[model samples]
Target chain A: MTGAGNSALLSIRHLRKEYRPGQPVLKDISLDIDARGLTAIIGPSGTGKSTLIRCINRLVDPTAGEMLFEGRDLAKLAGAELRAARRRIGMVFQEYNLVERLSVIENVLTGRLGYVPAWRAFLRKFPAADVARAFDLIDAVGLDESFATRRADKLSGGQRQRVGIARALMQAPALILADEPTSSLDPKTSVEIMELMAKMGAERGVPIIVNIHNVELARRYASRIIGMTGGEVVYDGPPEGLADAHLKHIYGGEEFL
Target chain B: MNAAAREWTRFTPGERIARAMLYIVTAIAVVWSIRTIDIIPEFLYDAPEQTADLFRRMWPFDWAFYPKAVHSALIETFHIATLGTILAIVLALPLSFLAARNFTSNPILNLIAQFIFVSSRSVNSLIWALLFVAIFGPGALSGVLSIAFRSIGFVGKLFGEALEEAQQGPIEALTAAGAPRSMLLVKGYWPQVEPAFWSVALLRWDINIRESAVLGLVGAGGIGVALDAALNNLYWDQVGLILAVIFCVVVVTEIVTSTIRSRII
Candidate 1:
């Protein structure tokens, strides 16, 4: 296990989250994420996988924890400070979560909302460089130039996920968090998405923390794998070390295996 | 139980008894209310004769009255509705944000906004006209103010509901992208609700036109004053002309509005 050394990009200590007063979803958890490469968190449904990623971004507030990122405690920030922290962290969702009524280019430009002024965003007058970069990122994610002007609702599931990836990359973020980014796609598209994510992470040198349900995809794409159950990390090692016993421990059944 | 032998057509004993009781209660209430209101079936016998007589008196409409009394008043009615709807939209824009659960989040502000919508909607537009007439005195000012106040509740209520029913997925995405509240409102929410907002605005304008036409009955201004005068003086021909102009205006407005709506949405 990586300790809270100088090389760690983010260091979390004894993190805990509870929606209700007493019933905690994430128990006291601790981990250190490096600065580059893909790390996959695999677990069953309703096991606090989404909650853990949301907590890192402060989308779900931590009941008790210390999340140190860029020399500040993320769990303790509020208002502008919290927003500033969030700007550096890009998030992708299980659903594409694109603004359906907005054009593809406009959705991509929304990633710069934190840096741009409100009036500019309202008028859609992003800076020239931002616009140029948006087009570039759209291309980077395998979308053609014509797709930029189309409404998001008109795209296929795979195409929308490609847009989702472009939108997240537009932020120029320090870290990326993907909550089931490929769950809605077919097997072929899912593999393509995972490959694109892996390639993007490698080229950009930004670490990606992905919460996924498919163990095979995680093994194929991730450098490291963290197996979780009941809000606790049951297994943490290289993806090759994740075997049938670890899967049994994480899923609590051998019928499917 | 066999796969196909069980009964599927009959209600249980409790359900049958409850349904029978409901029918009996409804029947009793209807009879009691009818008796209490003291409606006489005999009075309806003369309705057709009275309607025919009124129609006969109103024939040969006074076309000359249009340029003098009806035209300017008709224009004033249009002005009242347009200005009133614009003002209501301006006021309702923020009020709806306050009323929406996803937007406001504070219970107290939500309650206040909802209370304002309910109270404004509870009063009839004529009652609002009456109140404004007392306060602002007669003429187009009172009519405009009355229409604005009456429409605020309708526009605000529907706009708030639209905001509430908007897809949460994009909002979550925006929040995750570190958008400010204002940005969330404009980029995240505004695009989703734009069509609904325009539709409501057009529908309210249509309603206000019809409403403003009647405002002059209480001296609040518009063509209603001409209508009241024609009725009082027993100039049935002028009244017929005024009604015809109003009908034409309303039908044209509806056609124009529906066309715009279809094109935009």
Candidate 2:
């Protein structure tokens, strides 16, 4: 829950996610994400960093928690309510996760799926406004205009991540959650992606909660850093404030970190 | 990579003797089985004269029978295959959902579906035709049931496997997008499975056309009746003519199916 002031756009309280009994993947983790900036969640493998971000959208159901987004408790929501909450929060994935067979533009339009009726979505009949916005998003993402007609599978990895960003942008979301969105890219490409993400988040004043492994990149781009270890929130602060001691604690060793 | 192990080794005396004895026994068994089955030859001894006798007796085909023979029988054959395929595709689509591990995941449901499909597929179309002939009694209905039963099993098994390996990314995205369960099947699942479905369905259509032709042996109506009748009367020429027609039918069906399938993909 947010503090008495409730300044955050999304609030988490006592969150726990357990895939099996007595084997908690996320244990009693909680944080508040205020609107208007980028927040990076940094953690090593198996720390439930991805699970925390996915939980707000209920992608991976939390075993127990209070996740409040926009005045509604997401953890308590179900069915339509959960979907409606999710629509406001866009997500990008490590693999880009664009429907490979679909065109880049079509994938962008998929962000509008929450707004469109099921029939419209089923028939690929997005509203004209949605289509126009999709084209605009395609243009905004630095893709060639004609590339909108190309299938996602044909794009290079960097281009696909660009499309992934565009698809998230298409949602016009107040909040964005990215799960290791750069892990698949080259180091150079990963920075370019981080730059794009930061630029987009800054331009829209949308708080993006990103789960990333690249601590240096996260330090460079993120306004706030959230480090998790062993399913617990270990360190939550500004990037410069997180020390080598914390990195060792979060990753559990110097070599891996 | 070992030199000694990789070298070509000669057989030991005992091994050679065992091999000789095994070969002798196999040859004897094969000959006995063939003789018991009446496939071994008095005809081999009189091969030249017997061939001549058969070909001569297999006379000028009764071409007058062609016009009457094709009337209801051939049309009904196509109808049976068409309707059977249609019904099987319809039935198999849902059964595939139950059978797909990603979709149902219920072990009991999956196992039951497998049992149903396997049992249906285990019997040959002729056996199905024979069984249905007993029930539906010597008509196109028997042929339809036979084809439908066999196709249901085949289409279900193949399509279920396709559903398993289909790109999980889209499915994951769809669920994350908050698509309903029914929406998952119709919108997300169907699109992914469409290409596999169309290609296989067309291939099955080709096979079913040939299966329909053979179903007539058990009085499930088609070219098989004519073929069977021609053989019963010692009309080898007419039997040969029927085989030629069947060959033509199969070739044309294959061409048509492939052309349509190419367009679909």
Candidate 3:
């Protein structure tokens, strides 16, 4: 089936995830993500925002429901089909999970692992085109040529996240999901990272669904805002439509706001 | 009541009693061992004289005998250690992946791998040498197999632990990238665990060197065969030279491995 709305790129329907048998992390959640622009999911910790994003990629399998993208059910796929589907959807982690001992260029090139043969990957003999694309994406993410050879552990948090974004974009994805990509960063770095992600997503014409706890960043960067509380969506609309009442409801208090 | 004057002790009364019992048991064990050994006063009194005589005989180094006996035997010991370590690494590498709970996740496979490691470790290399000598009919091949079989457990166990300790974040990133199991291993797991893998291999090789030097006692070829021949013929000087050679080799290997380990990581 196509997306719930024909214009949507990913349609998640009645999705539910329970890490435990009876304790659901994500309640029956249904949302349609459009083909372009950034959609930010704003929620407090423990509200299943991370789980929801992960479920779309099947990193955390949903207990029930359908994730329809590119005319296939992501939740129903297995083996090779699942991997093929996953390669089209890029992911960025909260921790900027670059392999610590590897060089920056190598970490970024890992995005093409799904398409590269095992022997080629092992030999670090990625195809010339993929290598060129990886370098372009790295430059696009604001890392200079000098940083490419440096080991990942030597970089600052912002630099590492830049590499993380570059790696995600190297997948040539139709959709990118960033799970709290700036949680560990300073406010300035967080804003820069958000800006970078938005720029990369827009430049590539890829729809981005980001789970961010920063309400201000969400308001500033997102075209659409999805407010979640207690594993359920409290609001789904354009950024300007998200009012203080909605924030109070989503976070369960006006104390922090 | 002011917290009952803060009554506190490092050990409870029961623990104190247990500690006392442990000390008493240790004392009894020492006394029992001394009684069992049954050292004669006559021999004890003459021990120093015998040692002095032995050393006197061992002096001058047996320099002429080095080429005829010690040289070839020393070479054989080195070969056995190197070959055995290489063989163990090959055999243990795959088993380590199976044993690591994070890597395999199959409890049955993990259990099988653990069983093999435990079995290999439980049999001492000397005992393994004896067994292999019977099967392979006594040669450097038997010595090599003995060291390898005994070492598999050690190398596998440490490497498996290293694999298990790999950070989950990098693994998650690769899995999200849709890398297959093999790609994940080559790019994801291998990069993270490379230093540990090399560390374990080098450590095992160092241990194998010391162990192989003794394997020839059971007729598996190594310097111990030369030592045995010297001892049987009562060539104390020759025996002394063999012992010195072994000591020097062990010291050199220790130095080499330590230098390599420091540089690698």
Candidate 4:
């Protein structure tokens, strides 16, 4: 695979996003992600980490960018092409954005919505294999079968995040992007969630890219760490190379370090 | 500068003058309206006596008329309200999605949906009943059409607002998963707005029931036709019985809707 020269699963180049004119959130971001292990992106609030992740799935359109994922230019894809590309990328949210009124099983099944016919989804008549896979995924994400029938709103923060993971994995995605998946969880739950994600990524052999606020958690769980500051990546290395000097540079303060 | 010596008034001098002027204008307007409205002094003086005499004639209602006309008319009224509400729901559901800015994101479509709602709401049900009666002829069909048309605005506007108010988080997640627009609507938006949809439907149904009860006044059909006939014939006893029945049905519908709304919400 390395002999092909361009072996990156996702290659982002000159990705720029600005919500308002002249006030860019992501400034000329360029990176290549290989197809394995967990990569954690650590940055302070409002540093464009979430925006960066969102741009990959085209949830937040980039002002200007080139994101080559699989074989398509993600930035140029529109309509059906955009949707087809999105189905390959699983996304976990900070809020565990499961449909609050839907049952857990339904939420997981929604991960297969891109593949299922619209009418079947409307009638809640997902294929039997997809249903079985969803059930297995629910169990794999650390939730028992009992959780499948419960409403998502009834789950605690931790449990909800687990469902979120299962929902993402249900897509059988080529890549997984988690945008602060552990931020809403308690400290212990945060660790567990991160561990679960890392384990899941390894098991499925899918590269996981996570945007995280906690530096320690990133260092602990990430195979590769990319530190960003002011919409620019300041440090890109293994966890051991992320020293206090790099931390000060990335966060723009020495006292916090 | 003593803090205690500082003075404060609810309104400034300009505001006080403005308020005083408003009151004077309101008083003058009321007086003008009262003077403009033609009220005969003799009728005004005998109002209490006329009311008492009418009440005296209305008592011991013609209960014998219950099975003959009022019962079937009452049932027809209920049917008009229920069917009208169901039809309105069916017609307004798609329009509501279009009207919701978050859902459609097209200004022109939103404007068209909103325009339909406003036109539907601008005319009262009675006025709509008149129009429909002209088109469909005086019957329950006219009443149903009037109720459905009038209610589309109310149900569409409120349910559109509910759709707009739905959390964008789950929708974003669904979008990221590459779900098609229809899937997002059915799986994402529908679940969030389902309760509000039912609540709005029930509320509109309740109001439609009351409105349909009076469509017969315009020859559009229902219990109102029987009530109108009794009033035209000067059968005060039958009128009293019809009014009493309407009151009981309205009260019962109110209770039923509130109970269902509470459970759904």
Over 4 Å off, model 4: A1-4, B1-24, B38-45
Q: Which candidate would rank higher by DockQ, 1 or 2?
A: 1
lDDT per residue as tens, model 3, B167-262: 989988988888888988988899999999988998998999899988998999989999989999999999999999999999999999989989
Best by lDDT: 4
lDDT string for model 4 (B22-126, tens) is 999999999999999999999999999999999899999999999999999999999999999999999999999999999999999999999999999999999
Relative to the true interface, what fraction of contacts does candidate 3 keep? Answer: 0.71
**TM-score of A-chain in each prediction?**
0.97, 0.96, 0.98, 0.97
What DockQ class does candidate 2 belong to? acceptable
Candidate 2 residue lDDT tens string, A1-257:
35547788888999999999999999998788898788999987888988888888888889997887888888888888777777788888888877776788887877776667888888888899999999988887789899999989899998999998888877778898898999999999999999999998998888898999899999999999998999998899999899999999988879864
Q: lDDT of each prediction vs. the true structure?
A: 0.92, 0.84, 0.93, 0.94
Worst 10 residues of 3 chain B by lDDT: B1-10
i-RMS, each model, one decimal: 0.7, 2.1, 0.6, 0.5
Chain B alone, candidate 4, TM-score of 0.93
Better of 1 and 3 by lDDT: 3
Better of 1 and 3 by DockQ: 3
Question: Fnat per model, in the order given?
Answer: 0.69, 0.24, 0.71, 0.83
RMSD of each: 2.3, 4.6, 1.5, 2.3
Off by over 4 Å in 2: A1-5, A255-257, B1-75, B255-265
Best by TM-score: 3
Against the true structure, candidate 1 reaches a TM-score of: 0.96
Q: After best superposition, candidate 4 residue A53: deviation in angstroms?
A: 0.5
Residue by residue across A1-257, what tens digits does model 3's lDDT show? 55644777888889999998889988999999888999999989999999999999998999999989999999999999988988899999999989999999999999999899888988889999998888887788998888889999999999999999999888888999999999999999999999999998888899999999999999999999999999999999999999999999999879887
Provide backbone clash counts, one per model: 0, 0, 0, 0
